[model samples]
Target: MANDDLIYKTATEISALFRKRKLSPVEYMAAVIARSEAAQKKINAFTFTHYDEAMDLAKQAEAKFMKRDGRVGVLEGLPIAVKDESWIAGKPTSYGSLTVGKGYVPDRTSPNNERILKAGAIVHARTATPEFSCASYTHSRLWGVTRNPWNRRYTPGGSSGGSGAALAAGMAPLATGSDIGGSIRIPAGASGVVGYKPPYGRNPDDPPFNLDPYCHTGPMARSIQDAILLQNVMCGPSPHDIASLRPKLRLPTEYKPIKGWKIAYSFDLGIYDVDAEVVANMKKALRVFKNLGATVEEVDLGWTRDAIDTGMRHLEHLFGTQLALTAKKHSKIMTTYARNFARKGAKSKASDFFKSMEGAVRMYDTFGPMLEKYDVFICPTNAAPAVKADFDENKDVVRINGKVSPLPKVLAWCMTTPFNTLSRCPVLAVPTGHASNDVPTSIQIIGRTYSDADVFRAGIAYETAIGGWYGSRKARPVL
Candidate 1:
């Protein structure tokens, strides 16, 4: 491994270094602190960067690693940045929301981070997110907005924006992110990093199934291998999440090559107003898959507008009631747009909500059999090329094909969300190529239910073929 470990230095490389005693876990932890502090001032990627606690944990990991014990886990010395929404003990886990940041402290910690802690990794910092993770671009009244590392004038993509930016800026070795409607993958694309939105129940949730339909907590990293390493530590079923599968869970391995694998590419998955640069970059990247001997076809996934409506109504039943009480009391603090958006969802009747759920059930069932013939599905991870610095996700303004479009329609460019509806399928977001503006455009490669390793395997092939993400190490110096 190189001394300046900036590129796609996977967990495998780090592990080998640790095993050889070439790198101490504490040294990695120090790097995490310095890099996180540096990335924070430039990108606003973290809500809190824990220095003392991280080193304390790293020392323990160093001792454990030096013992030459076979029991040391795969992620023994790894440092991970967790999203603020997913709690870490004693940290200010404000979900980047005005209410929570004001003083909505919790007495308990998130079971997800707790599981990672038990696996021997350290929580180096807590990344930023949208207020309550409401939008696709990450901006919050509490922590302000996070800028992309490629260009500070643009957004890093949101909800999981901080996680994406932190990883992209080399703030931490890896980070945790929760996706509800493309939160993880969207930012992953914008920041030119790897994001995996696991099938629902893949990783146990702390609060269980709060807004279960589109919510998924998964791993995000700088490369396919790091993502797999973090996923290995965090994945497996748990009783905590009633939706989770049993403890025997593991990343499915595929020794098969990428040659001749059938990949279906849906430009919009039926309908979306996307940027020309994004589309062009994606199409160009498709040729790489073709060169790798994969049969890439522009196949439609046959999605109807009801997919969005169905997903939203599901949100209404879940978040509507929960946020209504909060909204009703603090409606003044909430954005007029956000309050109205949540309020509209809050008004859904039981009948409509049930019908939406039923329709989604039928939709997924109808969609499942079609995937039996294909190894994976592909699509752009976001609507536009990359959002501007002040881009308002709450607003309905979106330009597609030189015409103004609605936010819901263009945001539909995210072919990544519906798979989360499938519960056990795995979706890996890999940077395809940089847009005309130099920010990266990414595609989501989704595998069948519980086939996460297949997604990682495909990502590995793509990473090897395309080489690493460009300009990944250039960032403002925090010092």
Candidate 2:
């Protein structure tokens, strides 16, 4: 296979090759490292690289495969890009901020990272994120802007922007991402990659935030199956996390067909002013489902902007409060967006937090029943194609369908926050098609609460119908 082909190969295919001795782990790792270095120059996706250490680990995996032993971990030789926010023992967990991350080192790896490491996936590099991961786009004082590989002028999306960009750029076959307000799906949509946001406790998370139902640590990859591969390792019960679910649910590599399924779609989710291109792509994607023998229909969620407001309030109460505390001592060093987010969070009252919880209960009253009727819900991931690579959420304005709006109304263009409010729904983000600028447009496949298998089954069918993304040299980003 060509070097480019090798670079874009899926994690499952790479693992199969390693087991058959058709490709050496070290060789694959070296190629991935080279691609990562090249992509880094173009997109600035990584915070830190461990090429040397990764090669050492890759050698060990190669040795294990050479021995033909059955002791190899499922992810034995694949290079996985870890988000900067995740902790690795004795390694810096930056959270994309220079304030608290400057000289800090953690003694224990996060549960998700520990599982990935145990599964034998090589952590070749740490992907970048917004300061404290407080924004929707990935640009910060610590790490520069992470651009979309398809179109560098646009953002890859955030706060898991780096992981999404890396997968799109073929920097790694798999990567880790944490979503607390659309972080994973935002980037996944913008970067045209597959991202899975498992139900809140489906995957283990570190303390404090793990307790926050809106928070989720999931998988991002070039393909749905590859996303599942990493997710299988990252999920399950963890002794350290009380929120981790019991009786682990492991998804099968293959899923039953989605034919005869009922799919419901919404263009704007009743609040967003979606771009024409996004709607066009969404319609085309729905046709794919229709062609597969699934019945597609439009639905009115009866959801209003209040859903977005409540989500922001909840995030401010939990995630933003943490940042507000950090900003008390390090305001000058924090990113403008992060500081602004902290300010809003600081102003939140206990009543506002309680109202947010009340709002969630109300929103779910409509959504929970809607899922009972439809096998899954589909909608545009973001109302617009994407913001600029260096988008400043504090001051920047987003234009969707030629209607410009300020930062306060920005969530009107982002449709993922409602799912975060629901918290238990499983969401899978998949590309629809690229817009005129070449930045990708995507849709979310949302399943019933904790029905993780439903979303994957739909995603697999949709992906197979679309022939899988980034499978050929021409399909990959030119960068």
Candidate 3:
């Protein structure tokens, strides 16, 4: 196979080739590492790398495959880019902040990292993120900016922006992403890749974030099968996390077709001011579901901006509060957005937090019943194509469909937070098409509470109908 083919091959394809002795793990790893280095010069996606060590691991995997050993794990020879936010023992996990990450190293690995390592996947690089993983676009004082591989002027979306960019640039076939509020899906949509936000507890997470129902650690890849491949390995109960669900759920590689399935869609989710290009792409994507024999209908969520406000309040109370504590000592060195987030969090009251909880209950009261009526819900993952690569949420103005919006209102353009408010629902983000600027747009496939398989069933069907993404040199990012 050509080097570009080796670099961009899906994890599923790479794994099969490794098993069949048609491709050497070392050869594929080398191509990917080279691609990563080249892409980094343009997209600034990786924070650190372990190329030599990764090469050594690839050799071991090749040896195992040659020996026809039964010891091979599901992801035996794949190269995965781990989000910098995840902890790996003895490695520097800079959450893209100098104040918190300078010279910091954890003695223990995060559950996500431990599981990925045990699955025999090689981690060749650590992708960048916003400070404390707090922003929607990836950029930081520590690692500079991570741009979209498709269009450098725009962001790849965040806080898993780097992972999405890496996958889109063919740096790696798969990567890991954590979502408290659309971190994985935003980047997946902007970068034209696939991302899955499993229902909370379907995948094990490190504590205290694990205890937060809105937080989820999942997979990002160039294809739906690749996302499912990594998710199956990352999920299941772990002794390390009490919140993990009992009796693991393993998804099948293939699902029964979506023929005759009922799919409900929302262009704006009732509050967001969606861009015309995004809506146009969403309409085209809906046609894919229709072509697959699924019935599509538009629904009124009856939701208001309160859904966005509630999710922000909850995050400020929890995620942002932690940032506030960190800023107590490191405020001088933090990014403006991070500091602003911390300040907002510090001002939140117990009453505010409780009200946010009550608001979530009200929001779910409607969403929960809607799921019962439809096989899955579909909406644009992001209301706009993307923010600027160096967008400052605190100072920059965001214009959606020609209407100007402010800092918090900027959240109004992302249709993801509402689902995070209904934290038990599973969401899968898949690419639709590119905007005029060449930045990609995507749609979300939402399932009923804990109905993980349903979203994947819809996603696989949609992906198949679209003939899959990033399949050729022309389909991938020019970088």
Query: Against the true structure, candidate 2 has what lDDT?
Result: 0.89
RMSD of 1: 2.8
Off by over 4 Å in 1: 1-8, 102-105, 208-211, 252-254, 393-396, 409-413, 470-479
TM-score, predicted candidate 2 vs. hidden true structure: 0.98
Q: How much lDDT does candidate 1 score?
A: 0.73
Reference-based TM-score of each model:
0.91, 0.98, 0.98
Question: Pairing residues by index, what is the TM-score of model 1?
Answer: 0.91
Better of 1 and 3 by lDDT: 3
In Å, residue 339's CA in model 1 sits off its true spot by: 1.5
C-alpha lDDT of residue 403 in model 1: 80
Worst 10 residues of 1 by lDDT: 470-479
Candidate 2 lDDT by residue in tens digits, 355-430: 9999998899888898899999999998888899888765678887677853354354578999999889999999
Each candidate's clash count: 1, 0, 0
By lDDT, rank the candidates, best first.
3, 2, 1
Cα miss at 6, model 2 (Å)?
Answer: 0.3
Which runs in model 3 stand beyond 4 Å of their true positions? 406-410
Summarize candidate 1's per-residue lDDT along 292-347 as a digit string, tens digits.
89998876656777776776676666766667778978877775435755686678
TM-score of 3: 0.98
